[model samples]
Target chain A: MPIETTDIARLAQILENSGVDTIEIEEPGLTLKLVVDTRPRIAASASPAAATAPAADHFVTAKADVAGHFRAAHPWQDKPFVAPGQRIEAGAMLGLVKIGLLYAPVVAPTAGIVDAVIAENGAMVGYGTPIVRILPHAPSNPLN
Target chain B: MIEILSVTGPASIQDLGRFDQYRFGVGTSGAMDDVALRAGNILLGNDENAAAVEIPMMPFRVRFDRNIAFALTGAAVAAEIAGRAIPPWWRSYARAGDILNIKAMSHGARSYLAVSGGIDVPMVLGSRSTQFRGEFGGLHGRPLRVGDILPCAASTAAIGELGIEPAGITLARPNAAADETIVRVIVAGEYDAFDATAQDLFWSSSWTITPQSNRYGYRLQGPAVKPKEPVEKRSHGIVPGVIQMPPNGQPIIQMRDAQTSGGYPKIATVIGADLWRVGQARLGGKLRFEQTAYSDALAAEDEMSAYLDRLRANMRLVEETRTCR
Candidate 1:
């Protein structure tokens, strides 16, 4: 039997609530991985004007909050936090900037598909530097 | 073999130490965390006293000039090779041109990087350790600089034969309390010269490692331990871990680079097994001394030797198993 879409949604919800970033489950003939980005982003309430801007409908640039070396993934992780063309939800983590012992996470402002990764891994980035570009997700039909 | 890329602060080549050189007025300057040095060496199948890089300051970077197996121990620092993370007290193989970056220490104060067959610096006084005061041994007897290329002893071990895993050996103090370290000390012959009140305060009070502390000695800040009366004496021979009470009444524990002789009265001596604790103690860290009998000190040394023996046996077994496969 194949896993249903509702089951994947539930797994994603569970992963988000558990405070873990990723989970993998393997059965006899199926394997599923659920990853939830928990990094904090610029609050939607404070950026209402920017969210409504005309450019927001298509491309949105995610900016860093601190000056440090940018890393697309944790040092031990093999894959980038958010890969290009990956569909990501609002508030999902995009990447990280490490300053000394502290790490600041970059998060998505709205649900979107990643268009490009602007900041190179291991490159030093300054505050408000654009790190990633995203294309806003199109609205789904209510009847569907 | 590795080439130094950038160094944040002082780093030196060290082994166990230059032994039997005290009569010539030569101090035994070696790795601050000797336990870490031994661990790194053993993990890489090098001689236990082989020369390795003692990194006191962090953000040290080096590029592997050739494929080799290496081990890192001590100071729980964040380490990476070509951007892939590796845990402390673990061994891994690196390809040529892979940059190994060691970040600031998270827990301890120093780290040791040991490669297979050890660093091949010429020895002086029968040791490869840097005598910083004399400026005679180990990479021109100075800290490593950017673009310095140090030779590594030749090894025939295959890179595929090395395993990546924790060596299951630890030299850290067991069950130590948070933010405070308990170091074991054996009271010296002149310990009784102090007043009863001062003696009581010595064991009861916590001492802070002052910023003045270095590889020479740990200048501690705590309650002063005054002798019963002023007494003059000639200078006598001393070694690392000797707790000397100078005229200032503050206790100074001589370290690896300390002078061979001292005129101050010795109150206590830290046992060899517990000296690593003092070495890993960060500046401004808290330390409390606990008096132990002479026999207990001997037992601690035996325990340390036995732990190393077990680690060596395990490493050999792993190597043999990998070769058979």
Candidate 2:
């Protein structure tokens, strides 16, 4: 099982004592194979409960996938397409960009409500920049 | 089954590599010499993709905690157990508590040690690879050190003796005669920024790999490559081998440690399979770039993968046939 939380210490303990030195777990067709150090002594010098903190609440700063002019909203409208706390899905269009003579829509990477907008409308975006932050809500039907 | 007695130099757990996680701001850093990594696995009757210890210039010392079979590959590193030299490539069964030692590597830059069932290390982020940038993965996200006891899982599969061919391996190094290195790039989004002379220089001149080269990126010391047009752009996703040139014109080839996205202008991309060859290049190794069509790049990648597949299949067949005899 994927460690329910990101706790490194607890995960280490479970792996050491489990006797199953290597655990091959799969979720959503993605397999995660972890080799559990059966000789727990290797990590004996390591302290448990080290990485139990939550991920920092960093702002979403979506950049352009390619160099293009940022469109804050849909082509037909003038106001911004989304405000803070607006829910969005994966592949949902966050905005548009003008590349050459073509207008391309930037899609959301994850499912979450809109969190922040770093680029203003008509601004140019480059590679390796954040375009939108989707604050994922609790799964309504996780199994789905 | 094999106990580590002593370990010097940079040794770490490595697998095929970390992948499909670059979008999460992670770099796909793994074994520097993958050919050696696979050979080590074949010698141990383990999966070719199993994790192993990647050591560079080793004086490696290990004591067998139990009776186990292990193999070493890559470089011309000499091995000795209890002061008696052991041959490379072939698997040898060591008794419990036997001391195994390795001297300096003569030719290549790295060596791999594969124990049956592979080295036991907790996985992080879907890989046994040690990605040091995030300070996570591998054995506590750091290089293995002395007194670090490694465990191996028990294997139920048949133990097959390997016939290792040490002299058959070939290692790639920098071209000594070339005065300049030209790294080819297929112009991506912003190819129009430079005037004719600048574009001419980008393809013709050789770039030196600066001493600052690391898993994150290799900064090239050569002519500056600027775009034909000037305009500020927001950050987008980035990939390995993307030659990103900032305002200074010096291009930096992003390696495994590159961020997921960036605002720099990218002129070209290195093919995926050849990225490891780039990783093997030591600091100060000269690099030459020549443009190949994207289709050609894909064909090269397909051919390489197919060759690897055949190599693995042949290794497996040889092991099975040997055990039967």
Candidate 3:
């Protein structure tokens, strides 16, 4: 049977009640992804949302949201979109994942300075593969 | 709705050309890159004949006055909104107050911008394409200029941003010379008038697109092709893709905005399937004509149809994935 809207609502409620930050259910053509964001922002495109988790000192790694061949620069462009040490704003594009003719952008999840580009150019990447490493802008308080 | 903030290059609203008005002495004025325009409309779930902004030159910028889902296809331009560069052949939702600036194009000659709801324009003669000669259709029947505010049909459908592989890249013929644009053609009514040597020269010599080329027609420069005797012909009905040779022996391929009738002798007609290729050929570029049979032209049309069919199916699949969540 196909999953109903009420079923999805119930699953979301359960996840919220259990204090789960995120829950993804992938079954054939269906995918139920719910992320509890701490801040308000436009999140993802048609591609799957990247696994954005903060590491040491608010450092976050941006990963590929879709599976494709990683392209540092667009096919028509000569220079890569992002460079190490370059300050990036949230939602900024770091690279592209070219799947056939479709180019799925690898976007920055948080405002930060580029530390390194993890995935090599032209490398075949799957969903959640790290593409760029960033040291996120330090929170003014660092504590709740 | 969006406000045209700037237009550094020529742009105008167009749909599929007006076909019914040719008998009334009106020419068809449609997207030069109809394939891109059609695919873009399909991506936005808009009508196939929905009007879009055809931008041939770049550095075009616009500001969204309201939230709208839009698609950009054709040349691979660096189109950025809110600092996010969307690829060509892509659709995305633009928030009110967001600005989309299309910088230099890197690939094809023209680009099309199709919004969620097609650009709202008064249709003249059953089409929204700009009739430049008649000055009747499309926003005042002229090229788009800066500070023009165009309304869009109201729509509220949820849109998922995506892109499609352009048919120009996938369905291209592989046998053509690497540097020259090739368009398939069939011998026309005046084919028999030309001598064998002249006919051979017409097919073998490379033709360069002159600077005078526009929506009216593409003026080609090549070796003079003349018939054995000067044949005067009465002006008769013509359509886009008719390659007519004038008294000077230079060929002119009529385009979307070509006149309904001309007295020029026709040497060949570009097949409908490959007309888009000729339309996208850049000025100052070279083009070669390849002879094709009627059956092969139909097969080419079928291939184009299949390409569009697959694109529609892919869009449906994307919609399904979005709703399944």
Report per-prediction Cα RMSD to one decimal. Answer: 12.6, 27.5, 8.8
Model 2, residue A48: distance off in Å is: 82
Worst 10 residues of 3 chain B by lDDT: B155-164
Per-candidate clashes, comma-separated? 0, 35, 0
Off by over 4 Å in 2: A1-144, B1-10, B57-60, B74-94, B155-187, B228-231
Clashing pairs in 3: none
Writing each residue's lDDT as its tens digit, candidate 1 over B1-325 gives 7899989767899999998788999999888888778878877778889999988888999998787888888677788877756655657778878999998787778888899899999989989998888888889998899999989987435443222222122344675676788899999968889988999999998999999888889999988888998646688899999999987788999999899989898999999988887888888898899999999999988877776776677667656766797
Q: lDDT tens string, model 3, B208-269?
A: 99999988899999999998889898999998999999988999999999999998889999
Per-candidate DockQ values are: 0.02, 0.01, 0.25
- Compare the candidates by TM-score and give the number of the best one: 3
Instruction: Indicate the TM-score of model 3.
Output: 0.82
Cα lDDT for residue B187, model 2?
Answer: 69
Off by over 4 Å in 1: A1-144, B155-175
| DockQ, cand. 2 | 0.01
Residue-wise C-alpha lDDT for candidate 2, range A100-137, written one tens digit per residue = 32344566767667887766677656444466756665
Q: How far off is residue B214 in model 2, in Å?
A: 2.2
The 10-residue segment of model 2 chain B with minimum total lDDT is B165-174
